[model samples]
Target: MDLSIRVIRSDEWEKARELRLAALRDPVAHLAFLDTYEAAVVRPDSFWQERTEGGSEDGPGTVRQFVAEAPDGRWLGTASVLVERAGAESFFADVPEGEQTHVVGVFVREEARGSGAIDALFEAAVEWSWSLAEPRVERVRLFVHAENARAQAVYRRLGFAPTGVRVALHGSEDAHEVEYEVLRPAA
Candidate 1:
């Protein structure tokens, strides 16, 4: 199906909420995302409303969410990027040495897998990161579950290389999240 990839608008919070809930229920959600469906489903509308608005185009501007939308207005998948600067206090892992963008909340509907939606979303995300003027992004990075080989393969194909850093998966003792990065192109 034909789709358009673009940053989500602040007023489209409902669509963002629905898409996020659907993503949390995917079969690979256990390995692909940090939040569980049960935890997310219980969140109040206000929470979703704020979360959606924060990632929208009109939000604080350090974060952005990109979605793949079908011509019929259905959202197929989504990805979000969080810009982290050195010495900043991050909600997850420690901020790396440079100003970089962390790719997160990535999800592509099963039906849309391998349809190029993922690539399009990431392209929009990385392009947007590179276009930032305040702190030039030095790299783009993302974490993948140790067992998520499918995602690792996709990241490799997209030119991201493992940075030899492994973070313990939240709430999991035996699992790890591998870090991968793509540096800014030489000018």
Candidate 2:
């Protein structure tokens, strides 16, 4: 149950790839993520290297990935934040009213569920978002499949509230993903 949260390192591409593949294989991945294990597994090593570098602490500040590492060196969970500026084309929904951070690629190993690793990962991700220098994030948001009650409940417990904006899930016209957000704490 002992774990520490930290931003990934550029050299830890292999570990990042392994954890991401495992996440893609999780039961809820279909509802929680846009990429599939099959698709990700075929990506070249260079792709993973670049991805790791882009999300690493030394990488550009537009995105960051945080991992919860167990005492034994195993990654228990991860969450990433993408800075979204107003007027920029969003990958998921309409343009935002102001700078915000979108939480994505959330995952925790089954054995680590309810072990506090997920919470730790989220705290790091949200904290990093709020600490951005240039475009201070006004809020941290995430999209959860409408039917993913479990994830929705967990997010709500973590202080994210529905923002009244719903976007149809990509590739599924009928299904939707509800947007939830936690505004930055008052200064």
Candidate 3:
């Protein structure tokens, strides 16, 4: 089935929220997301409001979210990119003038995984990142659980290469996360 990829609007926050909750319920959610379903469920409307605004077309440059929607308007999957700057405190590291987009929260419904939903969502994100004019995004990156071979394979197929950086998992003494990067397409 064909799916369209686009940026979500503020008024459609509920759909975004619902898809997020569904993603949290996936079997590998523990490996894919940093937050738990219980934590998300209790977050107030204001939290959702801020999240929606931050990722919409008119929000700040720090973050953006892309979704794959079916013809009937149901969401198939989603992905978000966060712009990280040098010398700025990052969610996982401190960086020094170049801008990079960090891809996160990638998910496609089980039935939609092999179709084109994931690719479409990623293309949208990459397009948006490259479209930035000023602090031209230099690259797109994502971190994957070291144990998530499936995700790693998919990312590799999409042209991301391991950056050889490893971050220790916050609470898991034996686990680590690996970084992957894809250079920005030439103009």
Candidate 4:
């Protein structure tokens, strides 16, 4: 498909913002993401600039965003990883047994689905997490809404298994997000 997967650069904030907005407008966005298009679109440019800068390749090691870009320079998909250390406060789920990376903001354009763009994006994200030095990450994890079967299947295909740990979804008292993990391979 002539696509390349790479970490985002701080200078590409505008492109990142555009792709994110497009992701938020997808039909399954409500099920796939925590933020709404209305809220995201209303955010000032500076917010996107800061967000991109923080998650860029040269930014802090705590988080990283990967994107699949076509030869034409359009982003086909994206995935982000958040580093979590045991005993530290986590913004998503509880701290894990050891240092880990939390995968989030997973999205692929409808036309790009089944084209392997999502897979490539995830591979880059996971590889980057495992490459961290000193206090290396022990695993990578993500939470999917219980009803999102499509996403669950894809994550399973990528080797993530349910950890049997469920947490209530934000803003919803009755629904839950199921945790999944891919343990680091033995050397």
Candidate 5:
């Protein structure tokens, strides 16, 4: 099965919404996403439109969403990255004093697991981060739920290493998200 990996376009908002809803319903959604399916489902269409537009290729480079689409046009998986600059207050984890990209909204269909789609999605996301011009990204990072060993293994296999940083989730110290990162490759 051939899968094309590419950044999403603004007009594809509905498709993006569909994929996100499906992802939120996945069995591991609780551990993989901070947002709940119930919450996401009730959001207005405008919310999805704006979200997709901001993460689209035609939008500002601050965010980009990549999708793996099969020949039949179904999205096999999706991933998004957000640029966090130095001295800025990030909504999630704190960053070092440098610009970096944060990966989020990662999801792959259960049937698509083990199909290299995840690797391809990450490759596109990381490449997009390194391609930014102004305040060039210094590294690519992501937060995985502390109990999510399945995701940890995949991230490690993809060359991401734990940054020895962890952040509380939903103001609960008992639940945390561990940070992992990969520095920009030397030119």
Candidate 6:
């Protein structure tokens, strides 16, 4: 349960890439993610390089990716949060002009599941989201597949409540992703 949680570094792009590919190959990948291993693998190295660097601590202030590194240095899980701009719009919902972090791309190795890695990753992500300055983060949100009960339970336990806003799934408008959020208390 003593996992090392921290932001990934740009130099560790290869490791990050490997873990992501592994995640995409999981049985639930279709329901859990928008992209597939085949598509990700076909992308040029420069894409991975830029993606890794963008999620690194040295990257822009709006995006962050965290990884759970086992004691032996292997990555056991990963989570990413993207800060949304209300004026610019977001991939799934409206940002409302205040700072908000959209959590996504969550994954944990099968062997690492049920060991608090998911909780640890969420803690890191929520902590980082609230730590931002400037506009200041007002809330953290994420979308979960309607059928992903496991993920929904975890999010509820972490204090994210359903926002009553749902988005249609990519290429499948009839199916929807449920939106949830944890609002930061007003001062």
User: What is candidate 1's CA lDDT for residue 157?
Assistant: 91
- Model 3 error, position 137 (Å): 1.3
lDDT of 6 by residue, 1-187 (tens): 6689999999988998999999999998887898999999988888888999999999987789999999899999999999886576777766776778899999999999999999999999998988888658899999988888888998999889998999997688577899999998777
lDDT, ranked from best to worst = 5, 2, 1, 4, 6, 3
> What digit string (tens of lDDT, one per residue) describes model 2 on residues 39-117?
9999999999999999999999788999999999999899988989988888778657878999998999999999998
C-alpha positional error of residue 164 in candidate 1 after TM-score superposition, expressed in Å: 0.6
> Which is superior by lDDT, 2 or 4?
2
Model 3 lDDT per residue over 20-78, tens place: 99999999988888889999988888888889889987778678889898889989999
Task: Give the root-mean-square deviation of each candidate in angstroms.
Answer: 1.1, 1.0, 1.3, 1.0, 1.0, 1.2
Provide the overall lDDT of each model, using Cα atoms, as 2-decimal numbers.
Answer: 0.90, 0.91, 0.86, 0.90, 0.92, 0.89
Evaluated at residue 150, the lDDT of candidate 1 is 90
Candidate 1 per-residue lDDT, tens place, 36-148, comes to: 99998888888988888888989999999999999999999999999999888765578867899999999999999989999999899999999999788999999999999
Runs in model 2 deviating more than 4 A are: none
Clash totals, every prediction = 0, 0, 3, 0, 0, 0
* True-structure lDDT of candidate 4: 0.90
State how far residue 92 of model 6 sits from its true place (Å). 0.9
| RMSD, candidate 1, Å | 1.1
Write model 4 residue lDDT over 1-187, tens digit each, in one string.
Answer: 7899998999999999998999999988887888999999999999999999988989987889999999999999999999888878776666956898899999998889999998898899889889999559999999998888999999999999999988887778987888999999999
In model 4, state the lDDT of residue 154: 98
Judged by lDDT, which candidate is best? 5
Candidate 5: clashing residue pairs, number: 0
Better candidate number, 2 or 5, judged by lDDT: 5
Angstrom error of the Cα, residue 2, model 5: value is: 1.0
TM agreement with the true structure for every prediction = 0.96, 0.97, 0.95, 0.97, 0.97, 0.96
